[model samples]
Target: MRKKWITTSLIAMFVLTFFAPLEARALADESGKVTFTKGLDMEGVKISVYHQSAPLAKENVKSLCFLDSYFLETGYCVTTGFEVGYNGSENSRFVSLTENYHLPIDLPATGYIWLETTTEDIFVEYTVSDYLYTRDVVYMDVFVPGQSVTVFGIGMSDASSLQLGEKIIDGKNIISRSSNQITFKVPSDAKPGGRVFQLVNPISNAIPVYVSPVVFNDPYQPSQWYLAQQQIYEAYDVFAGESEMVVAVVDDGIYLNHEDLSSKIWLNEDEIQGNGLDDDKNGFVDDIFGWNFLHGNKDLEVKGAHGTMVAGIIAAEKNNEKGIAGIADNVKLMPLIVCDTMGCDAASVANAIKYAVDNGADVINVSLGTSGVTAYSEVYNEVIKYANDHNVPVVAAAGNGDVNGGIGFDLGQFKQSPVCNETKSSDVIGVGALAWLVSLPAWANYGSCVDVYALGEHVVSTTVPIYDLEGGLYTAADGSSFSAPIATGVISLIKSAYPNISNAALHKYLTASSIEGILIAEDAFMLIKEQYTSADDFVAGEVSAVDVDIQAIFSDVPGDHKNVQAIIYLQQNGVINGYPDGTFKPENYVNRAELLKILVGGKGIFPDAAMYNNCFPDVKNDWYAPYVCYAKKEGWVGGYPDGTFKPDKTINKVEALKMLLNSQSVQLPGFVDVAPFEDVATTDWFASYAAKAKELGILEETGYFLNPGEEMKRASISENLYRLLTL
Candidate 1:
């Protein structure tokens, strides 16, 4: 779409001709004449006028902004939207006051009329007002209680004192205050809502910051229902992963300066930027924010949003008061550009794969695919194989067909379709798209080749100027291209938690984690509402309901494993483990102390050991002291009447189930109206646990026998953990 040019001068002339007399009073007060920065001397430029009310323009209009599209540079004018100094009988509405790069308007208050030639430079001073001061924070992200958050805004340099309104957080402990941002922490008990921060000395501006009493908030996150459908919230509750792990996004060039993506971009510490020489001597010069393969240089020259959207889905910042919270975080995104204005070059795609693998990417995400034609490039096939050979898993999108009513194709019927066919291996996960209703789209490629599914349509993500045209912020998108990244983010979460995990192991986790069947939109909405209301944070329901087989990861366990999928799930997430000799020993009876260990580990709770030393008489200095004492302190366990924990005793079925449900955060019903087993009544001590387990199908006790005192074995524990973790 072409940029629209506004006839500002003509409109001003026409309005002046009709509304005003022949004589007009153009302001001759010329103390602050701003010379247009020499580089931006384009005549007859259009300016978007958004008038703000008196006293101050706030952060919404800071720092005069210029939107630079091809040949058209639109600058923002925050004013009265009327001609200046025209006091002629209140006739004219607007006039063309601008002439020869100089326009002066009276000061409504104290501020500056800053302008940018390009991205930066030039200022117009408006002096200061003795009666009222004008200052505001540029922007602030959602603040978590007891965590440091930065409040950035314009004109904070003169603030001598600061105060928070309504007693949300303490205004005393400021880490530091720059001209742009102030760093501080919110009180642990601050309630969620709008918070007013006043810069005092003489009081400038009181800006409202989004204060989240809970941990997470993103304006568009509720629209991001894919996170709910994919069980990403539950995965994050277990592990958010680490920043050391990297996922290389190979696609069209990304908007490096995107607000949501800038901080998460992977930096090449070895190379210096823009010196025109290869400081690292690896191959490319000035490869600071990963390589821009389009021109084989550091200049990203991002002309599209495909790459930015894909990368955002993989690693956009979470809980930021931005557009949307991306799936994965605490992981770096290596932008490996392989596409341009025309399209992606096959050879460039191959080179990007090699570069990503060599530079230590944990996984490679390719959203590009042969949409319509049955075109198979041997070069892409070789690179995919090369990536797998190096143990760098590759995830690609199954084709979204073509522009002519993109019909889904079963690539399994053919030998090679770069999107799906070449990606059926253990190291290559071919992804298909799911609609908002959790139903597969008719145009989404699905067959023996498409390995898994993720929400594709209406996926809200960070965007660039090309896609949005509004530029920056976010937009909802469709197609299988997006599904691949959501899957890639899940892989990123696992890889970040366990950097040493094998790609083949990740393949099993990824495949087994997904479930089929429809979850009607209304049911999902109601379930999510209850979870959010009752739970302290976001919770994701189970993804797949299919019973998955666990491979023999231990010497004692057979390849055709007998138990549910949780053993590998737990092991993969760094929750449970086997003996040093590689034996799982499934029959081993879980001791009281052992049960505490498993429960605590499953919850991903790691309290400081220093705080729990010698917590119990019999648990002093024991290996299980931390877990046992922490559990005891949380009221999940109690000591014997003799005041001894009796840590060595075997755990019974009732006790194990209670601990499992509590530690895993399974919500207890308000009232246990009916007992699950004939032997157990509503008044029984373990009735709630038993009922919850029965409702969730955690136990296979169809006969309704309450074997309350039976010893809980390692295998039974694994099965219980699986149901709780997965379900």
Candidate 2:
């Protein structure tokens, strides 16, 4: 009876299993839900459940384990086992099963799992996988997968040699190698999950690898506060300055061999080095790079740290993998040493000015100044005048003397000798120091003489090795000395971007486009704004509209004349004037008296009324008597051999050019040839002057003849004079 019962039960089980296939097929047809759970704080983990090998719904899961141990493989999910039997042939018996898992963590560990299901429910197979501890991992805030990253060890004992999962890192994986760091280009198959790197050289430990989205490799760019303040980087995005522009540093000797400055130093390719002869024959002998006026020699060996610092501020090479960037990175630094330990002499400064102007320097920086040397002093004044006449802008320090009467002594009530005077304002930019970009430094000289304000206090730049206390081949300095160079650098950048810009236009752009409201002084603030704003515009080749109205200022000037605008400009600026009848007398010849007044008045310099005691005896109470006396005193005019003033004498063309050029105390280069002029002879007294005028573009010939002996009409005078001022 028991055997009969067992047989009956087995037959019933076999009949039940055979008929259960229909119920399983109904179960497989019904859609099922999949739930996923992960350790605490384990975001981006995904699990999917599929039916018949079709993609199903995916669920993001988090773990319930402690956050600290989330990276470790903790068993947080309950597991159950179930069995299902196959009733068909061996190959077609089993149902297809696949578990798709994904984790968002960078360099996540992956493993396989097994699952079983019965007709009633499904079960999950659990397997242990590696974990990444956040504390053990060193990484940047963000990174793109499959990109390169430079990594250095933080707390790991042996970071030099590393292994990613059993794959030993070698030259194939590293893009570059250094003593303490390695740059690796992540493999293309790298997944966005936590990864473990084994440090195996000095000690055994697992280091987590994290990635950042971006990287900044320059070591010192972040510390350049002045560059940031001036928005130099933004300007750099448009233009980094051109290499052809040359900026002359007329300061103490510069460190020519500095790592950051050596490549940017101006080399005189036309002249041979150390030849002990004037190879180029401009003036100084053996000026291979630039002249050293202080020693009267060719050697640019740094005797003081001032020039080096100024040169670096103007142009220390950029993207060279070291040091801070200059405002104009591509500019050439022409070091014109004008000072030594004894300080700069007026003669040396003057010579340096001429050197910079005669050479290829596009900008001249005078970061040195005398405190009490009156602005009218001929010592440095003549050189500055020459620079102005040649269309080369000269930037000078407004003296270091504190005019506010603070921690330092003032430059006296009448400070900033030479540069502070009214005469220099037209061409010389007197710079004052600012602590930040907003406020003036306590020691910086201010007042009407200060043309612009620049970051000078605590300014960091390259200096001589002996003076480099910062150990990085650079040092921090302060004063108007640095501020002047900062302005020079800015001007150099503008000139580089717009090589065709006239000096007057360049000056206008710099003053007109500066930022406003930041500086203590209204003019200084405006200038600052102009410098920062117009630089990018100039680089973009944007032309600013002319704001001054020429036709309205001078009634005597005809609209048809070629220099009507220039004449109006001069008249509006008080440099020239019309006749008493409201007529410019454009067709009349300019008399000696009128010429003297125009030249003397153009500089904005005037002799004291009491000092004009009728030096010229021709006409004591003449209409031009005062001007004639002033001109005589200034050595700009003289009487005839018979001691006659000749106030109404009509000046000839050659005479007019000579007087105008001489008014600026300009010394022309040696006579080359007179071929430009058809009538002028090489042996004529004014031959060199005519040649210089042609070379300077001051005398544009309307015809083949240059009537040197003919009296110049008022129109020709105005046109040529405008060219002289703008050239």
Candidate 3:
């Protein structure tokens, strides 16, 4: 076995010098201080200085709060750590640093920022300053544990400055330093794997805090991902569990008593439910359907939180008026509790996966990994390969380590990396954890080595031990261990939706359908389109290039009932289209170009050839040309400053309706005395839209009228279209 370590002495020298002078600095008095009586001069951007004791101090600090200083100029992500100046100096400003590892010009993944002093007892006082515009580069920490990782694009002053551990499996370079940051070069030899970086501050007893290189868990952005799962569900017709998909979880054991999970648990209908006889007689007595590999008994009893947690993530009853919704509301959970109360070994895990594949399981989710590579690994890998050949998908979690340091917090990296290696299998989808922070979780790992990212940090879920603790019930805990199951559940959904789809093709389809590919806006309906219309028009019939159905989304015709009258009015008005299936996709995202075309076309102002020309690099000549020309001609909409007119972007109900209200034709009376929704505030952007929609009788304030920026559904669009036509 090979061992890798980091040389702390070389980097420790500067860390000692950086904080030694903090004790000599004096307190910040009101004399030279510039305190704003009303409020200090901060630019338009939201600005606030955390006084260190704020509840979110640790989080804000980890996110490199001070990096906002340099970012004001570049609008790029930068982090600034802690810093201080000479005692009682005339000028005072904390420094923030960022090192561009990819290129000197591009944004770097991680770095440090000098925080404004807050504590007087502590010589440092990170005071917040005004935002400004300037161009300045900073340094960062680079951690390399293995020589196989190739170092690249480092702004280091000397190559000899490279630091090596006790064993030279690799060499790490500590590059330049600006303000309070030190930049390091990433070795070019680095492959898609885990690495660790460290930050050493002078604070005593706070051993050099190491950062995991994997700073991000879910590579998918939030705006694009919002309601993505719902969209996926909408794309496919709902298929009940009995239809033909079975999700097998190789974990501790499942609670057959849990309401949400109980009904959906896979049962060998061929055999009796609780008969002590091995009706099928596979091996052990009463081997009803699923077996317990841990206890070596035919009890088939539900005992721990581990199996339940994993099961819940994959297939807890959804909308059944019970527990929290699982990824698939209706999917069979074939529980194979192989791990004991403490944990399990390679042999048991391998056998469990093999059992799932040998049996009727379509998708196998293994939430456990080990440090040892054994002949059983061959069995597991072979089983994974066999599952893949048979069109099954295996999802695993990337080992949690100092992704920043290339070492695990407890066991260190490289000791046992099952996810890193097993991912090589075509059937395996290795997942990494992402902290829930909006951006820059100092601890989340990042690298090409990771495939898809999901919410992993602080993730609360069912724990196996908690089951025994709560008496055969449920409890919640947090870990990447729990996240893998959600992904597994999502896979089960995809499989259930398209039973004949190959595992590889299903993976592609899921990735392609990922909402992360879409761009979201304040208006829920106006999401940006990620697909290129030029490619093949539409990969699927539901959304094609030539035409989109916007009507047929309602049940009760508008003229018949007061509630649905407005809905029909909009459709009659040509404000919306119905699908071939006679359903209106009212709530669906209204593409920007499509909305503009609808509005201009309704106004009878179609654009000509000359007006159809656009200047954006992304737009094409034949695509939405007339709509673009007409919108620009009518002053109804404008292109982004970059000259791009993103047409496929979805328009929210508020923005779409506001544009309608803004039209020269539509006139709405103002309401001085109208009741407001409990959730809608007067300061909301869509307040006027809501008010106007109510007066026009297009929307009823009594029931529901979601404000601006809320996602618009196909049904809502149909109703609005019908109302417009009636008006």
Candidate 4:
């Protein structure tokens, strides 16, 4: 058998990505920056229905934060000062001061500027210097009337003498104070209407915040474990939805008239239903709700169970004594059939995405995946990215189990098309299936690329009456496919509440709020069996979790260590070693040299030092020279921008993932219009790399920020490698 050798070139390709210089930012001495929006730049601002505020073109909208660097965001969904959770149909979102909306060119560039808002209007305004934007004093929030609520945007910690629409909320009512928020109790007598908050000690002009009661009375909501696991209930408690938030379901077909889904069907106002003409002038003829891209006709019968199940999971009528509750209480479902009994193809799927974007879909759910399809299609990825560029987020399934049958396959094993296309499109949110609440379901196609996970086992959702139905209203469905709609439903709800939230920010919130995916070490080890031709080549002895005594080897990894099995496997194979002090600092960060040694030694690669001495100007003829030079010669490692490879420095998750995937020749996901991470922007160099890493399941972190520059801890590096190994 050929020696199990890890190509040093792959590590070299990733080595250049490791030493990313963190720019030291000047300490901002400024306070909260606010941007007074259009139609509400003064106190008691009100607008007449006839007021035709100049609408800013979507492309021209710009936002500025620290360093005076402005980034473009669509005017339709740009961040504004008014963060109200009320109904959103703001037309003149263009601003007058600062970043969002349309900032009038004539407004004062700096210094004190009064911002005023009324109970009728909700928006944001510039507070501090134009440079800093850390705070906004008061943001739109619901006052629960007697219960303490967190008003998140206020920056003033010493702020006191609070008043909600002339109702004095004394300083004593303040429960706690933090940098970004001040939790305070609302007056019991607070009326149920929009109220502007006022505070003394560094006065702040605030937006109108609507306070009202919110609740979900769906009878069967309690039975759905997915809702709780995904924090759907918590999201609904804060923001309500509207019918305007449309989520297009591109599937084989949906039961358009299902009892629970009938009312939620999106009606095309421009098209005359039953009329054979292209009444809407958009595209298809008589496309009242959604068109069928498959047969080229509008025969949207429930050809299969998947579409209806997906639709119900997205926007089934809620609190209507329905079979079960959807993630979004109020959302419109545009059922566009792009598949038939033969299953979905590239051309039709692309058309469906284009249709959804053009036809006013706030979110798109493609709860489908290929079982063994390995063909590449740029058209499929382009359309997915196009929708993302147009502010429509597409949520897709990671996969059911294996790219084969149910045996199990890792997306890392090869390339997955459509679902995670070649570009690693930031727009497509690949959702994995989580079973038993915490486990990444065995067949979920669990890999380095799935963005998030949701309950996908034994889920109850609306199905056609002709099929297997539960209570004659719904059926029990299972698959990672269902997970897409679950995420889409949440996106629909959020889009309606914060109409100004861009798809990028919406994506950030979605993934950041996700339950972190997990894979125990023993299971991780077992899953990697397919990666190796022989069991002895992978692990020496039995694969059971009970056999490994990690403490006996490293004296640091306890029996309960999450990665104990992996550590044992690596240590026993002569891959990794403890410190001379006889302790394996699992929590310690792994540096470039240590990581290369672990991986190279694990793979049993023995490079001829004389032939591989000169790797780079920085990578000298040291202990790591053989691995670096060998990889460099093999075209695995590329020199950095500065023409040097810093193999001694530490690396982050993104660099490591990019190196591993690139080295293995794993097909990376395609380019997306936006970067999903809050801290990583579209223009960042590591944006696509980071996104690709995320798609390949190399980065399993769930949060707003990727913290891409932070050092990779030893255990995290092990977990990441293990993920790649099993993937």
Question: lDDT per residue, candidate 4, 1-727, as tens digits?
Answer: 0001100000000000011112211111123223232222232121111112432332332332211112222122323443211112343332223322332222222222122222112122222222211121111133346656554333347666667777877766778867445567777776543356665554334544434333346544434556644545555545344547888888878787787788988998988877589987887899887888888888888778889989888877777765667777668888888777766766777888899888888788877765423244456766765665454678877776544656345776655656666232245677778653244444567675677777776566777666652335556656887877877776676656544344434443444344364212112222233222331243323323323345544567778888776765555434465553446799887766677655554443435455777768887777678767766775656877999888877877766655555545566556657786898887776778777767676665777789888888887777666666555
Per-candidate TM equals 0.44, 0.47, 0.43, 0.42
Which rank order by lDDT, best down to worst?
A: 1, 4, 2, 3
Per-residue lDDT tens digits of candidate 1, residues 1-727? 1112110000000000011112322221221222121112112222222111121112222234222222133333433222233212332111212222212111122333333222223233332212111122111133445656555433355776665556534455676776555777666665433355666533134544434333357765544556655655555556444546688988877788788888888888888777888887779888887887767777776757898989888888877787668777677889888786677766777788889987778789888854322356555766766665455788888767543247666767643345643422353678888754345565676776677878786677888865676654677678888988888887776656555444544554555444562212223223333323221232323323323346666667776666635565555443455653456678899999888877776664544454665777999866578788999898888889899999999988988999888876679887798878988889988899898888998885678786888899988887787776666
lDDT of each candidate versus the true structure:
0.60, 0.56, 0.44, 0.57
Off by over 4 Å in 1: 1-215, 370-374, 403-405, 415-417, 421-424, 517-727
For 146-243, candidate 2 gives per-residue lDDT tens digits of 55555443223335666654556656766875433456766554432334455565322343343222112323443344554454434544554453
Candidate order by decreasing TM-score: 2, 1, 3, 4
Local error of candidate 4 at residue 532 (angstroms) = 48
Candidate 3 residue spans exceeding 4 A from truth: 1-90, 94-242, 273-278, 281-284, 369-376, 402-425, 438-449, 462-474, 511-727
Q: Is candidate 2 or candidate 3 better by TM-score?
A: 2
Q: Which residue pairs in model 1 clash with each other?
A: 137-153, 138-152, 138-153, 515-544
